[model samples]
Target: MSSSYQALKPARPDLDSAGLPYSPDYGDIYHAAQGSLAQARHVFLAGNSLPGRWAGRERFVVCETGFGLGGNFLALWQAWRADPSRCRRLHVVSLEAHPFTREGLLAMWRASLAPELQDLAAQLHAQWPDPLPGLHRLEFEGGALTLTLGFGQALELAPRLEARVDAYFFDGFSPARNPEMWSPHLFRRLARMAAPDATLATWCSAGHVRRAMEDAGFLVERKPGLHGKRHMVAGVRRTLRTPGKARLPQAHGGPRTALVIGGGPAGAGMAHALALRGWQVTVVDPMAVRDGGVHQGHTAAACVPLIARDDNPRARLARAGNLRTWARWSALAGDAAPLRCGALQMQRLEGRAGDPRDALAALDFPADWVRWMEQDEASECAGLHLSQGGVYFASGMLVRPPQLLGALLAFPGIRHVQASVAALRHGTDGWQAQDAAGQVLAVGAVLIMTSAVASWPLLQQTGLPADAAPRLATVQATGGAIASWPSGRLAGGPSCVLGAEGYVLPALAGRCVLGSTYEEDKTTWTQTARRLAIAEKMPAMLADAGLATTDGAEDWWGGDWAGWRALVPGRLPVLGPVPQLPDAWVATAFGSRGFSWAALAGDVVAASLEGEPLPLERDLLEAIRP
Candidate 1:
């Protein structure tokens, strides 16, 4: 209702008389007069008994209101890193409506970071997301530490968060300066996200703030403030949850066995996400050894996000999907990660007719994500561009699906069982994955079908149609193919992705990929005209980008790879638990956006299994849920 798209604003910091960053909008210093590092340790960590509570625990979740300079998070990381009994995994979810620029944060941390945290500071600088409204997850310490930054107003974003927080850090500005942070409504929603014994700490000990916490079910007390300040506040959720309503145990709790059907991008992402969350996952795919690896099935694909005039569900999904894909695959999720070389989206009608720059201006998206590019500027970014003006994505990537799957399936807790899963049944023990002969191959407490088009047959057996998961019967498949050429042949091809009716990627492994001809059938592409579809629809689009393949390109057209896309009428990816089944999930119908949808879809399922906060908003979750 409020701008539809949450356009996050970067902080225009103002320094106080003491040389510390202050907010002219709120008329308050960023942190205590003493310093952020000291304020973080004495006020938040010690106040919450963090090191003691999280000690020896497998995983701990912390939610904070303000992530100003991220000094508190850094301090917490330092404490966790130094402690031998630290939790095996740490997750910090924080919100900031006005986040500082990544460059600004790096500069601030460079001057203030201690020796022990210098490396962490550099990582923060490297992985900090653009000031875009949504969740951006940054990982460190081999992914043992996760920081989820929500760049939006507290009232707007808190209700969308789905987490069971163990502790909270309520620090951004004073309650008097920002009343919304200490509002009764925000406190109540946060309380709903809190665990039974969840605790919180804040530098502000104002009376109204205390009353708000009490009204929101927190038992509050006034504590000694830091430095010369008079008082600080600390509290805990006072009520014990009823037996049936309590959150299910996490990594250390219960058997974490899972059967993931599919070895493609979706399934690989699912396997990686679950394995990271401590699940003993077995991936079932018969073609793994025969047709697996980077050279087979689909060699390379574009993983860029999309946008629309109205920022529709598809656009939002792409943004979230790209964020997840770039963040996860960019690091330890897999070895053959996607190359973040960026993409150039061509406006088919050119700059003068049906221009998108006007619509983009209204959206107010940060320049770090996407911005209108003139032909001259686009040429420089692309390295060999000579064509129409359009939007350039600084965060797009080119992904090798098979290589990614190979690496993801090799994660510690995931095992690859090459099996033809023909049937499924839920019985007394758990959900079972069986062969065509009815022999059970894998039995797991949780089952997620991510087999793309192949999943439809198996889904029909789950008995979910008569009860739940609507519009599933209408799922269809589309066949698509892409042509590849030796980069040596197209010597002047753009160094960035070029897209119109279809797209071409920069060279990888001495080869450039182009053309994604789509066909109505889901199983196979029409071989006769498969290579010419792109040229037929948008003639000479490649030639305009200085990538003319008119002569030698015809010879390399034979090097084409084909795949199938599972899609429904609306083209949204289906995810979440099946309505009538227990712990059974589906993440399919990605259609043509497999590379874009796979990463975030995995998160939706894993978050359900872990009972942790979701990476997406509630409305977005429902729009695609099975």
Candidate 2:
């Protein structure tokens, strides 16, 4: 509609000579429109029949056209929070041609905000993207609710989205004023996003819109409108495949059953990715109880490349990995693996100096989203006191690796076994993954993602050098280190996450985690003693940055943090199809950056296995291949 965009703007709705809202707290736009509460209930809540339709469903997806002021989103969230019968997951896909600024969006949220909604609003404000095209995913409610905001014209984005909607809110402006929104082209795209029998409701009952909907294969109807309106248009998708009846079987290419020898992040992540692409996957790991067996309780890592200001393979992969991982984790919300925090990588000297930051400054990284924080701001933003300069990473967070692995294990087509894999044999048909008891666990395309220690035996016999290990010490001659402790002072810590001598997480499960040591070519149980020693040295580290305080210290939360060897060569993880074996692949060597790169690696592997378009650049994928 011509006026549809205006309706979303903070301007008077009914005024003939429209007056832009002066000093409009973005929140007031909704307040003025039948008041924010009523607008949400009538326009968004009722328009989609949310709470009622979501009852008893495992997952509910709602497609929104306007997303004005996010009032409808807030209302739907409130309803979901209040409803006991709501779906287990809520996915909201919204299209906005012109998005409001983060500051403006927060102001809008404050007008009619509840505590939970306020928290979500704050997150949205924090992660709001620049007005760029493509999808910007925002996760909330521990990943239970996901909002995929497509920042482009509805017609352009509708074709790229992959979702089946349960309901739709056609909240565009009046058809007479905003006819572009009511075009037949958009209606066709809407039809594509809807599942069979998907319901849709709109405040407008204009003849042209009804005709357009009918032409697009919806059974249109006219229902009583809200308030003084005579009628509202509602419709159901008439063109779509019915569930179960139209489901396609997994694509089998010679080898059908696949085997994974490890149940940790690398193996489990590969299993999940392959299963998503319609492969039957079996994961074998002896220590695989539930959740974290050998790899439990480890803090999450962020994907930050060791790139100077300019764009390099490291920077490109890190950027893509960051966005993809954020989206994947958001979709798997409420699964045992939940990403509770974000990460920020800051520079020691603040502004550009001699190294990477200079290259970074050249790319003009999104200043609005990722900006340069001066020393004072960086120190205050990060709870850790700092005296030196550095770039402040605002979205960094320590992740829960066990939780993430658990989520990957739950994929429908993937099966988990607790047997220790003893060997892998490659034959003409495919590969056979066997356990110590010689029981054949699986036969098909195989992916080896076992960690550095486990990988040596498997690769050594295959003529691959012992240097083909997952441990970083092979290349850098250093072992890894980490420690966790209990502390409450970090609860209300700074906004920007900081990393330097050793990274620190405020706390999860009531204790803060700190440490990590780097030793050269050491693969023993020396990590704990080193962590204890570092724990003693932490005060000096924090004191060096002017953050020494007794209140931030406490007993160790998870005992002495141990050291583990990473298989990475130059810190970058190895990914993609394994070069040695024809149908075999590998997802390993993530080092300290496992959390950030794992999900992206999974995606790349899945796409390669399925022969789908690679989501990442080809060169980047080639560099990480085994």
Candidate 3:
């Protein structure tokens, strides 16, 4: 499938005289006029035999074509909550071409929803995702229920989705008005995602829709609709199409114990994600922090997505990963909590699409995600003068690497072992980490190599085949540094991160962190402590603003921390199984945005190992797979 696609158009839901929402573009009602809740219970729930089909199962997945107002999802969730035999995990993946604003959903649902489901509706509204294109995962009831919303065209999204759906809810607009919603290609894609003996239900009993389902390998039947007002459509998956094609790998189930081979952002992230899933994780690193100490002597970094005029894979990946990180970590507390002060990414050089404003205008990205700001406005937002205009990211954050690392590792069930593994070896226990003298550091049924560039040597020692995944041998250890100055200096610094060539971070502990400089030198970052790196040329933009000068001030302290980033061929993070090694995984090759993407990478590994619904889409997971 082609990666290029247009941005999503905002949903425009209109309330009719009876306070029912209808699509103005398609000129169709959102649901049957009898009542959305009643229709959902009859057409979607009862028609699919849901609560009973999902009973006694470990996990159940449901996919809906159109999320409309999420009435069907709310109904399904409410029923699941009330069922004593409900599955351990309920995953709902829904596609929406144009999702209504959160406020619109709140107002419409509050005024019209049944009182029993009002609380769930409010929770759904509170967690409604920004209409950025691609998948957005929302967790409720402490991860027991997850909703993965695909905010884009179904035809473009269904084929790229990754799931083994147990039940399908066809709830889009009428086929006559929205033919694309009932296209053969869409049904084929849905069939491809169906689990064994999966069931489907839809209120629309159109003949074409039934034929499309039959052509896509479903056994169709007519079902009674709510109050017998009309007939509803039902389907059972008899055989899926596209036989002998490559399919998404099911989770590699094994013992719940895992051994992680690093203690930095990537490794700690994996440890925490697995820990939350009730897995016992042992993290092996030579630079492990002591008990109650968050500082493994790492530097501070900014977690802001870069802007590309074309919105390439890099841009989209960064946006998704950065958003995922914020969703996972913004709730952390205490003195070391991440600074959610946002960021000001100044425009550097001229682009094919002019500058930041033009790029944003062409993309039509949600302003809540990012907004183009003029120089004066940018200066005002940053609490300082700027040399040029650029994009302002209100979701930008400053993360202290060591603190984040510590907090992640501090989660229950994640045991930290202060030892380095010179190589890896698999034995009866599954995967084992060993030191230079052949001493074992840790062992587990599954292993995640997040040991940065050191993982390449470890993989080589384990005798990986010559024809391993493409680009496995291409990881490079690129070194860099960030200098820190007192926040009182640089005019108290900007209230947020200021990025151009080199970025500046908001102060923590009276010191502000400047951005990094890349080079090819290696360092004893793991074997030693209190390692600080020397930053490169300061941005002239800051100098012009008189925020800080390039004349080299000796007052800068906080020991500019030096570190190395694992860079892959395409400069994206590589995660997932190690080609032929089913029990082993690797999450490395995160370039400069290591901290930004680490959290999402962790969730991906966790979900994959637990046989749960994937937190990322198939195409994206493939793009970053090792």
Top model number, TM-score: 3
Over 514-552, each residue of candidate 2 has an lDDT whose tens digit, in order, gives: 666666645654654565554554443253422334343
Give the TM-scores of the predictions, in the order they appear. 0.91, 0.57, 0.94
Model 1 clash pairs are 162-613, 477-522
Candidate 2 accuracy as lDDT: 0.60
Q: Residues 386-489, candidate 1: write the lDDT tens digits.
A: 45667888888888766776777788998888878989998877788989899999888888888876676787886557337675656777777787767766
Lowest-sum lDDT 10-residue window in model 1: 242-251
Task: Give the lDDT of residue 586 in candidate 3.
Answer: 93
Which regions of candidate 3 deviate over 4 angstroms? 1-3, 240-249, 290-295, 349-354, 522-537, 543-545
The lDDT of each candidate is 0.78, 0.60, 0.79
lDDT, residue 165, model 1: 88
Preferred candidate (lDDT higher): 1 or 2: 1
Q: Candidate 1, which segments miss by more than 4 Å at Cα? A: 110-119, 240-253, 289-297, 332-335, 349-354, 485-491, 509-511, 522-525, 538-540, 543-554
Q: Whole-model lDDT for model 1 versus the true structure?
A: 0.78
Write candidate 3's Cα lDDT for 105-202 as tens digits.
Answer: 77767666788888998888878988888889898988889999998899888877777788999988888889999998888887787887789999
Question: Number of clashing pairs, model 2?
Answer: 46
